[model samples]
Each structure stands twice: as structure tokens, then as C-alpha cells.
Target: MSGREPIVPLVRRFSPTLSPSDDESTDSEAVHPYLFGKNSSGWEVIEEKRRCVIIADAGAGKTHEMLARARYSAERGRYAFFIRIENIREAFASAFDVGDAESFEKWIGSEDDAWFFLDSVDEALLQDPLAFEEAMRAFAARIADARERAYIIISSRSYAWRARTDRQLLDQLLPYESPKANEIGEEEIEEAVQTGMSDPNKLTNSIDVVILDDLDEDDIRMFAAHLGASDIEEMMQEIKKAGLSSLSSRPYDLLGILTKWRSDRQLGGRLGYLKHSIAVQLDGINWTACSIDPSILPEAVGRIAASVILTGKAEIRVPGSANDERGFDPIEVLPDWPRENVVALLDCTLFTDAVYGVVRFRHRDIRELLAAEWFADQLANPERRAEIEAMLIREKYGERILTPRFRPMLPWLVLLDDRIRREVTAIRPEIAVEGGDVASLPVEERRSLFHSIVEQIAEGKDDRGARDNDAIARIAHADLSSDVAALVERHAENDDALFFLGRLVWQGQMTDCLPLLLDIARSRSRGLYARIAATRAVFTTGSKEQRDTLWDSLLEVPNKHA
Candidate 1:
């Protein structure tokens, strides 16, 4: 089962404790991923809640788990069906022998205890966003109008919960305050789901949201052992030694690591892993089997990826279509390449999935990474950079690069364009947190970019002084530990800065911040909250020796302060 069985993984039901002000969100709050939990996974939740929305990062394996759930239902002799968003109309029309999506919508929820796993809403949005949203709301309405009898599960790449109204529409009990890293545990998982069915008046109306956690150590090793990787222990040790423990924790990234395990290589950062994986995948091709050169695949795929960025479309439908907004023949982008050969190669590649002749990168993250690399190469030219900036900002043309879908690619864009510095600081400072880690980048430039954002944080306290533990923990990527540690040291006197630092330490992979936390915890001059925050972090992540030192400091605290 890959240790991914549906179970009651830790979940944060909307807290009943939200204050009135929690309903209002600022700009930054509008784009954040919600809390992720580990426990029993999507399978159990689907069985328990008649309607559930599973959200996760791209490549966190939502599609795979959904299929598994469908199988589980079938073995039990329950009716179950899986649907992808791209071919929603075609698939439904084919299944029910109907004419179009509208007719199919009318036909769904026709069977009681029937489970419909609607997958890949994010990819659908990338193509036809308005249509996708309407389809979901419509399908949900169909489920609702059916006397609330049909079972349903939906999954999406993490999209920001845009408004309080949106939260209410989903029937979230209360707005979540951007979760903290250490605030969750199985014991506190919101009473294992309270859904619309429990309330007689609200049956099937509430769609409870759950995010699948990344592969924990046991899950990672299970997959490794399942794959029969030689020297699994050595492989795990090597990954940890490379400071890639964070990346390896992700199911998608872990599979890449395990599949390409070699005692000799350093997987490097995310970009490095991509490069290595690309080379390895290219190796899987037998050049003698065809006229196409191995290098051609990357060139073609890279161009296709860049096209996706400019168009905000993930699919390149074969032969094109008059009605498909996302459709484009591959040859249209690469006028020189043979359409059949390129599509064949792409379909064979591990990194892509071809559904009913419509091809998409296996995950949006892959698409974003490839596009980033391609754009970085082009942005090297000053004139091209100017053209791109104009187009991205114009909002009417090539592709709106400023959209949230493009955020993953912005760090790569920033690497080549100096003019984007303001946007980096003001719009998406998390760019610095993510980009600081690439093995190939210049550390000084990234550090400079990060500190400017930190200064912005120094501006003032958050309205409620609530910690966005998820956002803060994201900064604790192992590669960024030193950069974060330096920033913490620089802002030891700034309570806000210290507060952010404390969060990173306990809730994040902040191995480098222990000494600094100890120093602050032992300092009598710091605020009680700051000292307490630092003390918690020290005790949480410190070594036995470090804990002994912290214990000694604690003993002296009353007398020393007195």
C-alpha cells in the first residue's frame, strides 16, 4: 500500500475559536497553502465524509491515492468512478453514453453510495479556469440536489483560500489561521471530521478539506524497499548527508531520489535533482532505436514548457482543436520537429502523462521548473527580458506571468532579471526562501534578496500577532538554514524577527539556529515571550549536550535575572 492507506491522518478542522477579525485576509494571506496533516490518508477520509476536498502540492501523489481509493471501493462491491478534469466532458459522455458535459452532469449521482473522485482541478484551471470552477460547483450542486446520497471526493493542488466567503462556501467550520509547524498532532485532529451528514439539515452540503502530508521517514523507506533499491540504508544516509532530507521527504522527490540512487552522486538542490533526473530519463532512451537525438527531447520539452508559462496552459492537445483553449500541436511550437516523434517521446517519458492524446507534465511543479529553466536562458538577453516584462505585465497577451500559477517560476526569472527586485521584495518574498537553495545559484545575491524582505517584516507586527507556521516552516529548507540562521542573528534584537526565527526553529528544519536560540533563551534582557519562544525551540531540536546547556541556563535564569 506504500504506507499510504486511507486513515485519520492529522487534520485541522476549522477551529471554532476564530475571532471576528480572522475573517478578513490581507493580500499575502490570499495565496498561502493550507495546513497539511499525516495520519490515515485520503482513503479513510473519503470513506468517512460523503464529500471531501483533498488539497496538496503538485506531485504529492493525489492522483495515485485517488485511484487507490477507487480500487478499494470496487473490491468492497461499491460503485466508484474516477474522472480527470481535462477530458471531463468526453469522459463523462463516453461513460454514460451522453452527448456533452451538461448532460453528463445531469446523469451523475444517479447511484447511491457511488464514489466519484474528481481529480486535477488545478491543471483544469490552468487551461479553462472559469469552466473548471463552474463544472466543480455544478457537479457539487448535482451531488447536493440528489438527496445527498452520492459519495464524492475532490482533489486540487493547493490553491489559496481566497476569501472568508469562499471558506464558508466550502463549509469550513471556521477560518484557519495559516497553521504553525508544531501545532498539530493526531490527538488534536478536530474530532476526526464533523461533516454535513452529522447535521440533519446540512447533508452532503459541507465539503471538508484535507491535505495529504509528504512521505514521512517510514513512508519513504517503504517505497524504497518496495522498489528494491540496493543498499536502502546507505541511500537514506546519503540523502540525509546531502542536506536533501527535506526534498527526500516528498513522495515525488523521494521517488526521484530512490529511482536514481547512486553511491557516487550528490542530488544537489531541486534544480540539480531536475537536471540529474532529466539526464537519467534521457538515458532510458535507446538512441539507436530512432533518428531523433537525445538532446532534442530536452530542447523540445523545454520549449513546450516555456509555452505553457506564456499561455498558462498545461496541455498540448494533439492535432489542435477549435474549442480547446489549451490545445496546440507540438509542431506549432517547434516548427522543425516531426509532431509524431516528439509526442511519442514525451508520452514515454516518466515526467509526462498523456491522457486521451492530451499531454501534460506529470505534475505542475515539473512544468513550472522546466519553464523556469527555459525562461532563465532567454532572459539572459536584455532585449528579450524587456519584451517578456512588457508582455507579462500587459495582461492581454503572451501570458500573464504575474498570476499565482507562475509564482514557482518567478525565482528563476528573478535569477536573470535585476528589474524584478521590487516584486521579489514586496510581492513574493517567499521567492527568496525557495530560490536561496538551488545548488547552482550565487549565495550572496540570494542573501541580499532575503534580507530586504526581512526588513519589510521588521516594519511592524501582524494584526493579530498570529504566526503563519506553514509559511515560516517553508523557509527552513535545509539549504536555506544558514541563510535563515544569519538573518536570525542579524535580527536578534527585533522581536518580530526573533518570533519568525523561533517558528522556523521548532516547526521547520532549523538545525543551524539552535545556538542562537540558546543565546536568546538565556538572555535576561529579551522579552518573556521571546525568551520563552527561544527556549521552546532549543528544547525541541537541540542535542542532549545542548539541552544540558539549556537546562543549566534555565536553572540560572531566576537568580541571574533577579
Candidate 2:
């Protein structure tokens, strides 16, 4: 279960829309082409058409599906070229000497006998849309007649391929406001579409569009079984109870959950569970040679993640390399450790060596989570906090101190502490205006925003509110500043605010806020909602002595209903 399991989930395939006279079906049908040879016969029909567009969201197993297809084709005596679309040009250049269609056909031996799996076309388009489109058009033109000789399968995100009715696929593929589309007349547009340049639907009259369906109950159960869970039904119940149904359907998220469940049976908060799972992975790695303290490994990894986020580069060069001048050395963060040991520790888990000896996290989500955790840890150090704040503020004025990808880290950044939240809002005031950054507003506005946010959380008006609360819990666990403590005290009388504050204190394990919670728990003036929240917070967060006193006070109340 640690390494990727070979269990292929069910997949659904749909044929392009067609006229009734076309005698083609548009309904999606479940297929197990990767698992059973008999089902692959239908895949052969798709292969005969020699063109397919696989569409799915991020982490939806599009790459895995394409890889599985390639494996199946290989088993059937077909040579499968699994090429990442981002490197498609390089792959083509290296594989064939001639650029023309006839040369390409001759190079492959028999076009009809080869299967080409082009993965992540959307990534290529995202990096350089215009260049990708031009290259794709040229490639398509070269292989247009070779369709019978080769099968070409390309994968893209749904957003990248979903064009307006009035907009041709080429137009959508053009860079934002690029004049290339305007330069092309309708005739050229139609020609490009017909030639299958960017227009996946027009690849052929019988193109198959396979949209990956989310995992169902059976898939989840089967996957859980693969993870070696003792009771599949109970695991499914826990997944549903955690409101992780949508996440469970995704392969990566489901794997993360399974990883955590294998280590710890208790299903906690999503972030905590994911972090724990990552820790378990790291712990299981044989790092005795590194000689680094296990306790500080997460902090070191978090620092690396922060560097990746700020630099906007997934890969980090090894220490002492010419590209490592940006203070990316693990020794810079873990001063007590040997440089080689630090490198070994980094190579342990959660990261893999990339091209040129650089390293990158296993997943973007893991990087983001670790960056957030690192920022939270930084809040306790005034110098580090100030340094980060100055850097962020400088970037706000377009100095480009941080990468644009760093923006996703903001939600997690603000959750470190109220002071950190305030600093972040000052850097991006629009966040406050949008009701997302509440700590920097004027006292009255902050109060209003806090109440609104809490109400939204209570009513579940926005799915994002839960994420916000999760962030809030991260910072609340730390000791609160006096100013923030006072703000909480003012709202302690308001039942909604008080309940939210109690939950924050409980979730954060805020030792500084325990006295207020204790007061509320012992008081009669506060309503039932406030008192109940306070009682829970005290019992969950207070010291043993404080809890005993609170218990005695609760028993002393003559009317338990009151």
C-alpha cells in the first residue's frame, strides 16, 4: 500500500456526439480495458480510430489511465510511446530524423502498429500555449494520413478543452489576447479543426472522448481493501462521516487517506491526517545513515517547501550547485546537521530527485501544505516573521519578491496568527474587502466580518468557510497576542461569536484563552449556546485542575437545564 498499487479502477468512455443517422452512441459505458483483455477489444476499436481525448481534473488519474492504456497496447504486440506532451517535441525530434508525415510513418515501422500516449497536453498549453498549438498543428499535419498506421491519444484538463461554441479550439489554445487567432480567417480555423489541431472533437468522425468518472462506493471499497483495511464497510462509513466523499473519489486524495489510515486508524481532520500520513512515510524510510534528528525533519522539509513555493519552481538544485546560491542549502536551516546528512534526509521521503540532481516534492499539494506549516512555525520567531512580512509587502508592490504561485499559500499564511493575518491583509487589502482577510480591518469592521464568517460557518453557507476555520485553528493553537485576546473577550458575550471563539480555542489548544473559556463555563449570564461551547472548550483544553473545578461548578448548578 505504500508504493502505488496496480489496482485499476473502473473507467467510463463516451463517443462524440453524432446525428441519429450516424448510428453512433453518446451514452457513457463503464469499461475495464486495462484489467481484462476481452474488454480491451473495445479499446482496439478506439485504437483503430487512432485518436482519443482523455479529459479529467487534476489528481483524477488521467496519467495513470493513459499509462494503463499503454500497458494494454504493449501486451497486444503494439509498440506504445508514452510521451508527456510537455516534452513531445523533444521526444519526436529524438525518435525520428525526418519531420514530414511520410518520414514519421517510415520511422515508426508501421504507423498502424504503434500507439502514442501524449499525456498532460494541458500542461504544455499552460506553459506556452501559442508554441504548443503551433507544434501540435505541425505534428498533426505530419500524421493526418498516418492515422491508420498509429493511434494518437492526448490528455488535457476539462477547462483547457471546454471552448465556447463561437470559439474554435485553436482560438482557446492561443495565449490570452494573442493576435494569432485574429490573424486566422474562418477558413483557416475550419481547416485547423478538421485537421485535428487543438480540436480534439474533430480528430476524426469516430473520436472517443473518455472523461474519468469519480470513484463510486464499490471502487472505494475495493481500494480500501487494497490498502489492507480490516473492515471496508467501517472505513467507508468513516470516509463519509468526515465529509470526504468527493476527496475519496480522487486517486491521490484517496491514497493520502489510505496512507494515513494504515498508520493511524483514527480519522482526524483532513490536513492533520495528510500531514500525519506524510510523517509516517518519512519515518518508515531508512534514514539511519543521515544521522539527523527525526523530530526536526518535518521542519526542514517545510523550509524546503517554502523555498519551492517562493521560488515558484517545483525543483530545487542540490546544495553547493551553481543554482543553489539562493540559500537553499538544508544546512542553512538545520545548522547542526552535516551537509551530506541533510541532503540524505531530504532524499528520504516526500521528495524525489528530479533532472540535474534537483529535488521536488512528490505532489504540489504536499508542497503547499508543508509551506503553510513552515509559515505557521515561523510566526513564533519575531525576526523570521518580520522578514517574511517585509518580503510579502515588497512583492505586493510588484517587486516580484515571491512567485505568483505563492498566492495559494496566503490562505494558510494568514491562519498562523492574528498578527500574521493582519500583516498579510496589509499586504493585500483586497482580501479584507473580500471578507477573506478579517484580522486587518478596523475594529468595528473586523467584528462585523468575524460575525459574518462565523455565521457562514454555522449555516455552512460557503464550503470555503470550513477551510478558513481550519486555517484559523492552525494559528489559534499558538498563544494569542493581547490585542487579539481583547478582541475575543469583547465578542465573548455574543453567543455566535462566543461559540466560534470557544471552538477556535479548543481546536488551537490555546492555553492563553482557557481562562476566558473557564469564566464562560462558570457564568450564568451567558446563554446556553455560549455556555455549552465554553464547557466543551474547557474540558478539551484546560489543565486537569481547571477541568475538575469546572466539573464541580457544573454539578453545582441547581437547574441543569439552565
Candidate 3:
């Protein structure tokens, strides 16, 4: 009732088919040797057994085998659910148009005759290991009842499988050793990519299980043909020589290569040159290297996003005038992103529906990275300085007047010096002293400006007892809490300020300021503020007297609020 149902036990007698091995003998002349191989005999046993687990290393031909079995079962007119385990719950539910519990029951009908193909079981395990085990238990129970009528097939990365020793369901499967000449061909690949077989037993008579020893040979030959061309092909050869050939396996990398070639049509004219360019970029790193190598990609991607969002430039143009005798600057080579880092940065920048990709840190994470003190220190270099300055202007300050509300734009302003300068001219600007400059004004003048701005916005508003809600929210996130707090203290009975201060109190507990955070938390709310005060009192405040005072204060809040 909770999860998926158990597969029914096999009731009908089926031949005990053995998994094919070169040494194994076949009883039926009708069975295709290519399809079943040695395990051809095990088909009977597998069918009778009900549930099954198939384990193999990466590139071990598990997909080929799963396809073979799925095709066989489907041919028999049985409803076959071939699901990739990456999205197990959704996949199962969709198959039955039911929830998880109902899907399990459907798969584990009383008669016990269903085939479920699950690919990449590791994904489910990685997300939630407990649910995976529970699901397997339900599967095994149903398989026991269904016997020859029901079964489960699963494929997972061998490395992940080796990690969880407690999974008894897998321990029972105990994988068969991989064969020596283990290779899957185009025929098998095509069948898998297309729809699979319907009938398990009648497969041999219905379709040919063709096999070819060579798989990638045709793709290799096509590459050779492209290189034989005269023009662009030569460029491609150079790129290959430079090391770009290694990225073909990654879809994104391939897309990047094609996109780059398209943008530079002159280079595109020669196919060879394009290929060579790809080769040069991808030369040192292959798919495996991307997966296994220690990565600087995250940092690199952060830098790229920083350059774009902080600096107005897209990083795809030449930095300086080309007429100068200097060779093309490395930074100006256009789209000069570090290839290995693109994936990491892209992950952080692009927010999407949670179900499709890995969950990411909230938007605040990017803000924190950009606001790091290191970035502030490096702004002296023209490029770095330009990027940071542009970022501050775009994100923090705007034209016309100073905004009275503190929105944590200090994360931007913090990078610059204390003496904030005003632009003398809008058209072609130079720093100038003017009434517009917040930093240039004396303390009294600045406070008067701040108060006037607030009064103008709050005129005739019922919310005068507190700061603007939006303003308070912004203040709560300010980088320099002291400065923000000082600004708030200047106002009379600003409850919105207190509320914002409370949030900062909470954030501060997670950040640098801890001891003083309690004061801010307690200063905010009279009632539910008890929770925050209690947490602080228990963990941060040292003396029992302080704790008691805080607890009593919290207890008194309810009566007072009531």
C-alpha cells in the first residue's frame, strides 16, 4: 500500500533457460545464438524466477542485453515497462497513470506477469537510498508470486554498486563475470535505441539478433573523409594536433565546437580546420578525464560569469584595437573561456525545474561568490577594475537620487574605497565634487538627505511607524551590518527595521557575527521572537541568568501580544 506492489509468483512451468556462454550448449535450434548466446538456456530459468538484477561495469554491454530481453518479452504481447532509473518514480507513475503505490500494484498483479526494465539504478540510489531499498523489497515480493510471468531488470554503474554493501537485493543477484570479447554492435545498438522485442520465447523465429564486431569504425572512417578535404580540413588537422579531438563524447563540448565554427564562417569553409580546432581544444581531456580528473572548472566558471555580469562585455570580442603591432592578446581571442570550467559555471548560472537537473544552491550563493573580498582587491587591473565597477553600478546605484533604503548593495560598494566620488559629466565622465555624491556630503547633510528621501516616500502612509517593508528587507541583506544598523537606529520605532534586523541576526548566526546576533534577534519581535531568543540563549549566551531572562521574556511575549 505504501510503495510499489510485489510481483506475483510464477505459476506456469517454463523451461529453465540458462544465460548464454560460448561453452554452454543450446537445446532449441529455433533460438538465435547471437541473441541468447550461452544465456539462451537461462531464459527459461530467468522467466521462472520472476525478478532479476543485471549488474555490469560501464561499457559492459548491459544496455544491449537489457534491450535483447525487453524486445523478447514485448514480442509476446505482454506490457513491458522499460524505464531509465534516473527518474524512477515519475517513470513508473506515468506507465500506469497512477501514483507510486498503484504503479507497484499494477506491476505486481495477482497473476504475476510483468517485465520491468530499469536502466541506471544508481541514480535512484544516489538521490534516496532508503526508498530504493524499500522499492526493491516490494519488487522481490511481487517477483516471488509472479514466477515466470513477472520480472525486473536493472543496470547500474559498477562503481556505485560496490559502495553500498548492505543492499541484499543486489547481493542476491551476484553478477555473472563479464566475457572477454564483450562488445555491442550497430545491429544490437539500433534495436536498443528503437523499440524492443515483445515476446521472450518466440524472439528467435520473429526477428534476427544480428551482431557486428565493429561498432565505431564507420564514424572513424567518416572523420578520415572529412580530413581529406583541401581547405578547412587542414585547419581541423591543426586543431586536432593542438588537442581538441578529445571532447567529441561530451554533447555540450560538441555543440560548443559546432557553434564556434558557425560563428567563424571563414574557418567553417574548410572542414578540416574546424575539426583541427576541435581537436586542439579537446586534446588533453577526454570524457573519462572530465569525469575523473580533479576539476578547476567550478572556479573557472565563476570567473566567466563574474566577467559577464560584472563587466558589460560578452568576452567574445577583441580587447584592443587590431591595428596595433602587438600580437592578438590571449584574453581577446574571443570566447576565451576555459573549456573544462564551462560546465561548472553553467550549472551555477542556469536555474531550472528541480526534477530535470541536480539541485543547486540558491541565488545567494552566486552573490556571495561575486562579493568575495578577493575580487575587491584585484580590481586595480583595468579589466578586473572595469568588471567590478560596472557590476556595482548596474546592481547597486542608479541615476537621479540616493535611495534611502538599505538593500545589501554594499556587497558591491564594499569593493571600492570609502571616498565615493561623483561623476562630473554624464557624457564622458570624470570624478567631481557635487551635491549628488552621498560620500562627499558631511554626516549631517547625508542624514538630512536620507530623512527627506524617506519622508517623501512615506508621506501620508499608514506604515510610518515602521520603515518600508521592501527597504527593511534590503537592509537585512546589507554586507556591512554595523553601518546598516547605525542607519536603522537613527529612525524612530522602525518595526520593519527590527524585522529586517532579526533576519540578519539569523543569517549572522550562520556567518561571522554570533555573540552580538542574540541582541539583534531579541530586539526584533515581542512574541514568536522567543524561538530565536531561546536558540541564542541556549547556544550562545553563557550564563543561566541570561538564559532564564531570555526564556522569561519569551514566555511573557504571548500574554503581552494577546
Candidate 4:
């Protein structure tokens, strides 16, 4: 037979009640008994209380192994804090919105005498660099100071780079062996056969425990069976184009070939478009093409868009009136633009929208695309490069949006700014104001301006849920802008605003607001609050339609109170 080594099969015992859905092994029923360290070397490692880091590339069974260990510890009555950092950050931030810092700290540090599994630290660290560093250091400090015993295990992509002890241990454990120099020829095999005949049991001790098995041609065919026809075609093309036909069959090489094909359309015609249009604008150039440094990417985008965002030109304008009369000045001709000496500025207002990621293109595609092309050429256009360089100033330092919380807000800002600039110019004649400067006016004056704008907007339109919240807040209560009452009109027949106002009324212990509530119940849709609130408010007002609408909204709330 062929001289392949045998694998030492270890018995893998598992909990009898485990199901496939519990693949992450979080549930007690899903714990595998065989995988527990008590039955294997894993037990010794954990018992030593030595810091351990398991290093593996993506899809290398890291999560499964980590989950098994966590479940094992938890089964023995130990608390386990399985913190998916991304989820924790989102949860903590939301909690902070309605609570305080102490509440957030308590939530994260809830579990006592626990084994903490901080999984996917790479994603956690990358998303919020500052928060990750602070949290990690703080956690280490907390665990150190804890009164009870707590085991902390952190899984991170950077473990290989940062865990010096683990690296050294792994290096020391590696076995180096080579075939004996004298056992090379056919005579040696004959001599070994005779020796084995004399001592048949000798073969047992000579076998290598871990052998690297080479994939034979038939094994490659079996792998091809795992891939669909399209993937096979793509793989073949990648191998041919990369000129790695001889080595492409290796599993790691095969994966890399697929990734490159997906990332770049260099070889495949059906590779598809990049998500953003700007990706097309920078065609054939590397993402790092400008060599400006990634540290400056966020700041560069921010500074370039800052003028557009604040000036009102960047806001989403209602159709037409794309001219400067609406404050849409093309910044290409503007003076004092830094980096002006390094590149030619395209002559168009850099209109941006939040599509296919944060897209920033000129409103007129033809003009913007032309500018994008010309600006790209500046790298090699020796003549204009210096001028472009002079146009953009080098700021001391800077950094990086979403949700009403903070995220998604940047896109809203871009959209709102554009809309405001355009509408202000169009409505300038209606209001005798100095330009479109809302901040320049006194607080009361601004409030007056907001009221006029809202009244003008609501004059003839059917009262739908669409109300200008900021305007309403400015008009009603400037100091309490974040409160819902600040956004509704003192008098409007919109059910949504009324329902929101109902809660405020409820809080104030006032029932005299029924007239306004009655007007809203008759004119618009209903059931924006809990059933009891809606029912109580409607019955108190004595309206048939309001009670019926309350019934409908009750159906919408799952598990609603009677």
C-alpha cells in the first residue's frame, strides 16, 4: 500500500440533547461532552489558569471551539458573559440614550463569578477604535480587582501578533523530523521488509502521528463536485489568468483566486459593478491610489463636504432651480480653496447624496464625471499638480455617522442642507430675512421664523403625518427640542401629533386637552400609543370613531394590555 500515515482518532462525546440550530453551543443542551477539556488536554490548559489564545484564520472553527469551552464552564454553575462586542456597543449606546453611564456600566458588568468570552474582537475593535482600547484596558483592570474568581478569554484576530507567550509555546511544540539518510534505495526497502518480518510489531512505534496529506488528482475532482458550474468556470479562468495553473489546486490558493476575482473584474466579465458610482470614477486605480494615507480619508471627505453641507447647497432641493439663485454655487471657481495648486477643480457644486454608501458627485453627471476624470489626472499632470496641492490646506489633525443617535444623521444633514438652501432662496421673498441665516437671528426671532415657515407649509395641504419637527420645536418650546411635544403644532388635526401630545398631557395630569385630541381623532388616522392610553383618551373624549380607531391600533400591538 501507499506509505500514508494514520490519524489518531479521538473520541468526540457530546450532549445527547443538542440540536443543529444550537451550533454555536450557547444552550446547555447543546454542550458536547467529548469536546470538554476534562476528557482531553484542554482541561489541563484551563486548570493551569494560564492565558490562552487560539490562533486560526477565518472559518477555521474558532467560534465552535470557543462556544464549547464557554458552555462547559457554564454547565458547572459558573456564570458566562458572552459579549458580542458589536451588539454590546449598540445596546449600551441605546441604554445610554434613556439612562445614565452607571446603568450602562452595570449592564456590561452584570454577570458575577463568570467566564467572559469576548468574541470577534477584530470587528469590535475596528468599528470603534477608541472605545475598543478603553473597554479592553478597563475590563482587564476590573477582572484583576474582582473579589471573586473570574476567568476572562478574549478572541481577537490580532492575538497572533500580540500574544507573545502563545506564539513561543506554539513554536516550541512544533515537531521537526526527516527520513533517515540511509533508507533511500530499493535495497533499503527490501531490508526493512525483512526486518519487519522478524519484528511485525515494530511498525507501531515507527508511524508519524501527524502527516500532511497531499491532495491527489481524484481528490481535486471531488472538490470540483462541491463547486457549482459557474464557480468552476470562474475558478478555471482565475487560474488561467493568474498563470498559477500548477499551484491553483491548493485549497488556500483556490480561495484567494476566488476573492481576487470577486474584488476585481480583471478576469471575469460577470463580476458585476462596484457598490458605489465613485468606484467607477476611480476605475483601474487602486483604492489606495492617491497615497494620501487612510488616516486622512475621513477628514478629507469631511472638509471637502463641510462647505457644501453648511452652505445649504448640499441639501436635497426640491426639483428644478438648480442655479446659483438657490445658493448652488459651483465651488470650482471659488478662491482660497486649498489643494487648488495640486489639482484642477471641477466647475460644479459637489452635490452629494447617501446612496450606495456616501456618494459625492456633481448634480449634473456629465459635468461631475468630467471633473472626476480631470481631477484624477492631476497625479500625472505635472503642470497642475503643484497648484492643486496649494489649494488644500494641511490641517493639524481630525477624524470621523448614523441613526438619530449619531449615525444616519450625516446623510440627513447632507439631504437637509440641500433642501434648506434651495427652499430658503425660493421662499426668501415671502419672509423679509437677511439671506438664509437661521443662526444669526435671536432665539425668539428664529422661533418666529420657524412658525411662519410651518404655517406656510400647512396652509393648504391635507394634514398627513408629515410635520416639520424642528420647525415645530422652534415655535413651541425652543429649550426642549428633543421632546415630542416640541415638534407638534399647538393646533393641528394630525392623529400622530395628537397621540404624541396625549402622552405629554398624560404626564402633566391634565384632561382639558380633549378638544385638540378630539379634532385629531376626527381628521386623521389613529392608535399611535398603547391600547389603554388610546382607549382611555378616546372614551374620555366620547368619540365613536376614536374608540374604533383605538381598537384597530390595539390589534397592531402584539400582547397589548386590556
Candidate with top lDDT is 1
- lDDT per residue as tens, model 2, 232-251: 67777887665455567777
Q: Considering every candidate listed, which one attains the maximal TM-score?
A: 1
Candidate 3, 10: how far from true, in Å?
Answer: 36
Give the alpha carbon lDDT tens digit for every residue of 200-236 in model 3. Answer: 2222221112111111323322433443423345435
Give per-model TM-scores: 0.71, 0.53, 0.28, 0.25
Arranged by TM-score, best first: 1, 2, 3, 4
Error in Å for residue 212 of model 1: 1.0
lDDT of 4: 0.34
Can you tell me which runs of candidate 2 are displaced by over 4 Å?
1-51, 88-110, 121-150, 157-210, 310-360, 375-403, 407-562
Q: Give one digit per residue, the lDDT tens place, for model 1 in 89-108.
A: 43344222112345335445
Candidate no. 4 TM-score: 0.25
**Who is ahead in TM-score, 1 or 2?**
1
CA displacement after TM-score superposition, residue 504 of candidate 4 (Å):
70
